[model samples]
Target chain A: MAPSRPYQPLLLRLLHGLNSIFVIGAIITGFWTYDTYDGRWGRLPLPQFKEIESIHGTFGLYALLLLPIFALYAFRRGQRRLIQPDTLAKLTQVGKPIWWYTLHRITNTVMLLALTFAVFSGKMMSEKWLPQGEFDHTWYYLHLIAWAVMILCISVHLLMSARVGGVSLLLSILDLKFRPQDSPALWSGHIRNWLSQRFKGTPK
Target chain B: MKQNLALTIIEIIVFISIIAAWIIPLLPKLEPEPNTGSLILSAPGAVWLIPVAAKQNS
Candidate 1:
């Protein structure tokens, strides 16, 4: 049999790359901010650091802003293809992982919104915002809630991925020969279908 | 049943770790703030430091 072609879609790859960079940025910056403002709270106290905190917040803001674009893409196109039974089966060898896919979409959407809220609220509380005292309690509560939601969603996402195939599935994004034997043409075809459907009426 | 139990345990552990990370700090605590000037470090700063150090070493 011919070697099964790589299955990752270009758009998926792009979104995954963007999301990875932004999330890593958010994590590093978040830790820095914690170190600066609330290191006492962390189990492993990170040294107080501020220089990157701004960068972290900035990346987080970008991530938050990009989320709506991601969501719009997901809801309009990615959702249909990703949730297809054949796709899920090919991806996980499981029959329609509906719960997982739904949770994934919902969590991702919520995470982006939460991140946005957290960043805005945090900025309000920061020295950057004028009349900073106006935002203290409300900002603090919103930031805390948003962080909590993002953390929980991420944990669920990781755990679900692990359950499907441990680290291999997670790493498969980078592995070229990531597709299973049964469905060789699915990924690229899905992307083409998505683009065509999306641009059907628009001018070339 | 066994697999379900194992998954449950793992879930519980993750949940506990998250809770502990948040709760432990609330308990009474005091420590001197480290001098920020002596060690100028930030989140992404560590990434740059390594390459610079490697260049200097080379």
Candidate 2:
């Protein structure tokens, strides 16, 4: 028999899919905004559009809104995907599969941190600054740096996932067929149980 | 131990590079700009809730 295809939880797929859409949108629009405004680094040959900043800000706002929810899910349900205490030790295994997996986890964690910095720095910026020829804002510079780091982190994330689990793992996140237990109908109850568990030992 | 040391060194370099990227630009003294309205309603699907005018001003 052929090997069974991997499955992902519906909620992970939904959140990841939406977050990816918004983040990627922000990334592309962010570049356009850069090209249009502060091309001190270099300018693309593409046409410049001043309104791209507003569009980029819109995508960034959406990404910012989705970030907390995605981060909560990542920390709570998908904790294994992030770096663990033993990750450093695992990285020492150099050529081993475990090493690649450890690197993948590190990349995942870095991606989360990079996105947080990008959005938080972006939130600190005023839309008027770019249009008004004011680009020296510390927050704006930090946001640009965050954008660069996010790109690098995302690249490493894809490379590490491909190295560790191959194409199957990459496809799993987009998989639509989920087990009954992972159904959306049970989400409320699951959340309630998780909340209760968290508060179980707390003072009344 | 050699491999571990090598990996540790690389990690340290990467961490320092990121920190440098963040800090180097801010080292120069720059004047802080005063406040302006933020892009709170800039995102798609967001509504702008215009505050009601004061009764006396109206």
Candidate 3:
């Protein structure tokens, strides 16, 4: 038999991959929209228009719609990757992969928070708000701040992934390899058990 | 091999982003505010926006 390959759950991979696409789309379009309207801070020669703002807002809305599902999976099924008090202790360890793991978790958490801010503040803004030369809006400023946080966190997240798991791990996620045992047929059963366990107060 | 592939992916994303940021700005802006307000749609004072109106005034 071939050496047992590392097993990342199929559902986890699907959710993570989908969310990554959405987050990246949100970032680029979000920045493009910012550069379009708010060129006062620094103007990129990029063409500005109201229509591009609509595209950015639509992507932001899609992310908002998908976020709760990703959060549920992260907190319930993949809780170990989330930062807890124990995670902080791991971060204190020197010369250990655990510290890198902790950094990954921190970036994951920050990315989610940044997206939340992006969605909410972005919803509060109108396409015309910035075009009318209105720069004093509180929500617009908050959205800009959220975009900045996302850029920083995402850049670090990219570096940290290579620093830790390396290309094999990253490519593993991108790979479409699936086994008969990891089929979607098992998902409903798993979800039912998880929900029942939650109601019955059983430990996850 | 996977590690190198993963790093290459990141490097590609960063590279594309830099290229895009520079390239996108080169697209034209909205057609310079329609220098001549459409003749049929003009409001009474809209003609004042025409350069000829300014020259005649001067």
Candidate 4:
């Protein structure tokens, strides 16, 4: 019999879904904006709409707003998906499953950094710069670099996940199944329990 | 032991890179144009106040 698919936390699925939508939206719009305004290296034949930048900015704004919450969850609750003290050590074990897992963790961590920098550099930029035909701003350059890194990191993240866990793992993240403990209705109680445990120095 | 040292190095590099990214923006006095008169404080902006604006406020 086939093994049962792993279930992800309901909150993780929700946040990950929303975050992916905004991030992908931002990426596509970002490319359109780049092609529209500052295609200094090579220009695409796509139609130029001055409004693409505004659309991209909106996507970026949503992403920026959601990032901290997602990051907190990732760093606090989903810590295993990120780099640990042994991650680098595991990298030396070439051709092993742990190496792939370590690489995946590293990729996840880097993706976070990539997203942070992309949002930051994009934020620092003036909306007027591109409209005015000016593209020499340092933040603009950094944003471009961040975009490239994000794309590469995201691609690697996907590949690494597929490598480590195969297709079932990828499908598992999208699965809506959750345990009673992971229910959204219970989230507030969980938070309260955590807080009480923290302040009162007692187990929940 | 070598692997552990390498891990430390990577951690240091990542930490330094984040710090440098934060600090480099300050060097240029980069501030988003205020919408009205008061600065439009955003979540990211609040995390790192514009160096020039902070200097003026202080």
Give the clash count for model 1.
0
Interface root-mean-square deviation, each candidate: 10.9, 8.4, 11.8, 5.2
Cα lDDT, all candidates:
0.53, 0.77, 0.68, 0.80
**Per-residue C-alpha lDDT of model 1 across residues A20-56, encoded as one tens digit per residue:** 6886677667666655655445545656555665777
DockQ-best of 2 and 3: 2
Please name the candidate that would achieve the greatest DockQ relative to the true structure.
Answer: 4
Candidate 1: regions farther than 4 A off = A1-6, A39-44, A81-135, A176-204, B1-58
Candidate 3 regions with alpha-carbon error over 4 angstroms: A1-6, A201-204, B1-58
Which scores higher on lDDT, 1 or 4?
4
Which ten contiguous residues of candidate 2 chain A have the minimum total lDDT?
Answer: A195-204
Q: Write the per-residue lDDT of candidate 3 for residues A11-108, one digit (tens) a residue.
A: 77898888788778888887787787777678677776667777787777777667667766765566556565565568789678888888887776
- For model 4, the stretches where C-alpha displacement exceeds 4 angstroms are B1-58
Give per-residue CA lDDT, model 2, range A37-115, as digits (tens). Answer: 8899999897989899989989988887787688778765887777776777888999988888888988887787788
In model 4, pairs of residues that clash are none
- Give the per-residue lDDT digits (tens) of candidate 2, residues B5-55: 433443454444445544543443323223432222223334342322332
DockQ of each: 0.02, 0.05, 0.02, 0.10
Chain A alone, TM-score per model: 0.62, 0.95, 0.89, 0.96
Better of 1 and 4 by TM-score: 4
Q: What docking grade applies to model 2?
A: incorrect
